[model samples]
Target: MKLLFLNWIFLITVCYSEKDGKHLEVRERLKTALLQDYDKTLIPLMNSRQPVVVELGLSTMSMDLQGDGLLNMTNGNILQWKDARLRWNPEVYSNITSIRIPASKIWIPDIQVYNAVNYGENSFSDSLRNPDRHLAIVTSDGKVLLYTTHKLQIRCDVAKTVPGPGEVFIDRGQLDWPWGKYECEISMGSWTYSSSQIDLKPYLNRNYIEYLDQNNSPYLFTEDSFKDENVITCTRFKCCADLYQMARFKFKVEKRGTVTAQGLKLMKKDDKMLLISPFLLFTLVIISIIGTLFTISKLCHRKPNFLVE
Candidate 1:
């Protein structure tokens, strides 16, 4: 009976793997279609005379330098159209609400921009773009998204436009997840970001957000039914990474017809850090032992030696 049960388990595992593979193929195809559609529809909007400004609300940022964990962005920034929980000291917000154009007669309303994130909750009303400090872009649209100095970098420039759509390539940051170290590449104009080695498709659903660790292997759904049993709310994982009290955020799942998200999640370092290489750990242990021995020796030498009598 035990052997039969083991065999049954093996078959289930194989079946799930097959199912996951098929689902991944569909996701890739959908991503490609979205890219094609975006290229055909939105590329022309880049030609406007008014500068396009991207506002990535602080709520979506993965790392908060300030203890607030949300952007009280004190710069020439704009408010997001959607409501967010980020607190603002009137003074700090003053810097973002509006920008002064030396002699220009126009005042642009700060527009909220998104990085096309899929794994976690990233709200449309966030106060900062590319909150994880992992994305960057350059474009002919003349839109700028404000962020801290540490995260600001040029990833690509809009070279030219084509009949179908303009092309854009942005740099992605190195993410250290349980899988390993790899770089992510987000191609903006095409509207797809891929880290072939990461395989984030498994965590695309709401229930699996924070629950996706090495253990408790969960399954992913093949279809795009937001009302599926897989959709869930992840509110218990909120934690902070910043030291200065300037940023803050919250998380919630939106269930209308299809399961969708309407809020942002706060950042928290996980136990993945515990998975450092054995060689690195060994080196640290050796250094610690040596330092302890040296301290003991110094203390013994300073004291009177009774054994010398």
Candidate 2:
């Protein structure tokens, strides 16, 4: 027993160390990205253009983690900003031609989430109707892969994938939590969906999904797991209407809440509107004071009182 206890302690220490290391690495990268101009890394080809313009929004049902590491949206649709001028000049990347993301960039582990998928008597057709529509799994590394009988394939980073029965995938992020939703987006070719518009406040306190958008009503689980026609029914959601409306193809919308190990939500406090900045706030106050003084001075100096009397 002593030996086992020692081993467990060692393992925990190692895990903690690794987690700290990863956090440090992320912090460093973020710092570098902030300090050094990203344009410096761009190939010359991109450098010739005017200031690089980037329009960032919370993609539908997605979140955007800003450089400052703030959680910025909830709804699946919110226009963050119009073509905002990029801080880095575009001319620095003139030598670069094109950028291609490698598969290794995505990391998703296949872990079976208990009581997630639910296969019920309800027909698949009732969910949605489209061959292109199928269940896809999300991996730990933020990659969403389509589920098949054999294995999952990592499609484009932002491509939409349909869900199927007994097919469980990781949710890169969910739409619950008090502060706000996760920050990410789905960029399909030229289109983008932001999460700034959707209401994800309902998902924070609960673990199992109570409702799914596709299903028009509430979903109830019979047991932790169930097998129907070789398909497993895992969880249920109530009032799941229009869950599949965003998909290009038609699919069943089951009313069920989310079932995942981690309930994703933002804990940090977000910045206030423009008035929050000390400099801006101070400036505005000064201006208001000056204006008030000027008005009072003008009124005292002349025309008003004696002429009116």
Candidate 3:
């Protein structure tokens, strides 16, 4: 009976392993399919300037200084001052047009945009064409800027996209490039302006704008959803020659429902383990019952064992 119980446990383990293996296999295939499908279904729309909904998530703002004599007053110094702040009403930003994506369903793929001719020629001609033109971010004060910048860089964590336990599709081609870092420098002359304040806004509107891609192809899309009505106010400090300052902003915005339909179907399929697990449990119960009955019967059939009289 003990051996039978062990065998049953082994069998259940094997079944679970088999089921999980199948799920892993399907998920891998689905990831590949999702990447291809995104390139097919959404990439064109993105390139064509279709408005893709993005949810405004958490955001951060920071500022610092660089260069020699930042706090000192000296001759022939390049005195520069920079400050960063975000000016967006969270309530208003959330109320803006958006799609309800199960928090887990959103993913921002690691997007790489290579100049059309500089990098090795690839088959995805469209991607190679003006890749940077489609990617942009809105500041708190209604300014639109490209995701790629020389002094400032912004990036969102791939892990943060799926926070909860709910299953979500890979949604590969889609991207949610968040503001990662911002750095600036000014040199050559003594400090003229005392201090400069930059206001960043997060708002999206329905206004359409046109831009040229890397390939010089024309495209249009609704302007940034995150918009700020106010502008940054700056106060000049006492003139100093060798003053320098730098600023950085880090923010997270939810890019909801970027996944394709086919990818969603595959995600649901992978979660079918919830349905299949009950049957597996029932099999284990039956095995336990048989083992108990066999043990009882063996005891009952034992020859009457009386102390040798």
List, residue by residue over 1-309, the lDDT tens digit for candidate 3.
999999999999999999888766654543343334232211111222322222111111221212211211011101111101212332444322211211112222212211112223321222223344233332333222322211112222232244558865442224322211211211111112122211212223211111222121111111232232322222333654423221211122221112232332111322221233445657889999999999999988887759434
Reference-based lDDT, each prediction: 0.28, 0.28, 0.28
Candidate 2 wrongly placed segments (more than 4 Å) = 36-309
Candidate 1 residue 214 Cα shift, in angstroms, is 33
Question: Candidate 1 at residue 273, lDDT?
Answer: 17
Poorest 10 consecutive residues of model 2 by lDDT?
A: 244-253
Q: Model 3, stretches more than 4 Å misplaced?
A: 37-49, 53-63, 67-309
Model 2 residue 309 CA deviation (Å) reads 95
* Candidate numbers, best TM-score first, in rank order: 3, 1, 2
TM-score of every model versus the real structure: 0.22, 0.17, 0.24
Backbone clash count, each prediction separately:
23, 85, 22
